[model samples]
Target: MSKTPAFNRRAFLGSAAALGATSVVMPSYAQQIDPYTGQPIVGATAGATPDAGAVQYDTHANQRHNISSFRAQDWRPYFDNLSNGAILCDLTSRAVHYWSEDETVYRLYPSSIPVSEDLTRTGRTEIIKKVEGPSWAPTPDMKKRNPEWPDFVGPGPDNPLGTHALWLSWQYYRIHGTHDTRKIGRKSSNGCIGLYNEHIKELFELSTVGTQVLLI
Candidate 1:
């Protein structure tokens, strides 16, 4: 078996790949030095459109919907104003709100899917582990959704988990990176939250082992 490569925080920060700043819009206050790539990660202004050139993975996808139009009231109750390390994912808007210890609020796009008729059990969970360049394994349920899914895939740019993954306490759920950035801010994925590779890299640097996560 090929073991996942060791994650070296410092070495990753100084790596050459961390050079350029990304254009995704995270809260200005949430910007920080990427532990993976030493460059400062800056986000676009909230509500700004994703890069015009971002590829659309699904050729027959429906018309794109703007997250801003989604009602905030539907999920605001889940956000804890006093939390130092809590992540709130609004499945309706396909957005993730990360609250850091400094009280900084950053917005990230995550692909969402309507998993069940009743949304419970997903309300509160914590990150159990963090994996860098994680390998991919399709769950039985995932295979049922698409029988063509392979049993396994090695870690790399083409892997479904992209470059990093924050494993959630909730079984089989994760906040992770995606190979197709176009999936961000869209209704896709099985049930896990998906982030752009750069976004997840920044998130991986900021998140700890026990960060709280609320999905609504």
Candidate 2:
């Protein structure tokens, strides 16, 4: 297993208290740009605290960070709807959860492509395909932004898709691995879900082509 971050509940609660309590919107999906990473992040929301068991820390940064301030409305409600596996991309928390015989959750920071608001899609979809060591092709829109961007990048360390990819039913979206570890817990993808290489490898091993993927 790759190095996983440590989770210390006592320390987290202490820091959270010091941070002060603030009221926020309900069913909060508010978005904002992160000052540190310059990537968009889901704004904090006002809701009941998540069960301690369901909470985990995203230890990519030196400071403490909670994976989710609110619980998934219905934990694993789509279990019966999946055959191969199921994945939840919690856009509100910048995290991912994989469901199989057993459940595994991961916190990620992904880069969001600067696109029109209409293009930011939200819904449930199926994993159309799965690939290992996948190549990347810049979209036409991406190329328009950077005329010099490479048309294709073969599987390698520099490949933006990293080592594994779970293609979604949505034509342009995917859940893939990332070579840049720093982007693991921020909003940084162009619609696709981004995970650390290790996390993706784990998911790839457990997931199959027909897996259900929820973008909530």
**Residue ranges of candidate 1 with Cα displaced over 4 Å:** 1-63, 70-76, 79-84, 104-107, 110-121
lDDT of 1: 0.56
Q: What TM-score does candidate 2 get on C-alpha atoms?
A: 0.62
Candidate 2, residue 126: how far the Cα is off, in Å: 0.8
lDDT of 2 by residue, 1-216 (tens): 799756343343234223321121122232133222345444331111110011111223232223344233334464564456577776655556666644443322222221223435777898888899998886766566545555677887656677998888887687887655434444344567766576678788888888777776
The per-prediction CA RMSD against the true structure, in angstroms, equals 14.0, 12.5
Give Cα-based local distance difference scores for all models. Answer: 0.56, 0.53
Model 2 alpha-carbon miss at residue 8, Å: 14
- lDDT, model 2, position 50: 14
- Candidate 2, superposed: residue stretches over 4 Å from native: 1-74, 77-80, 101-119
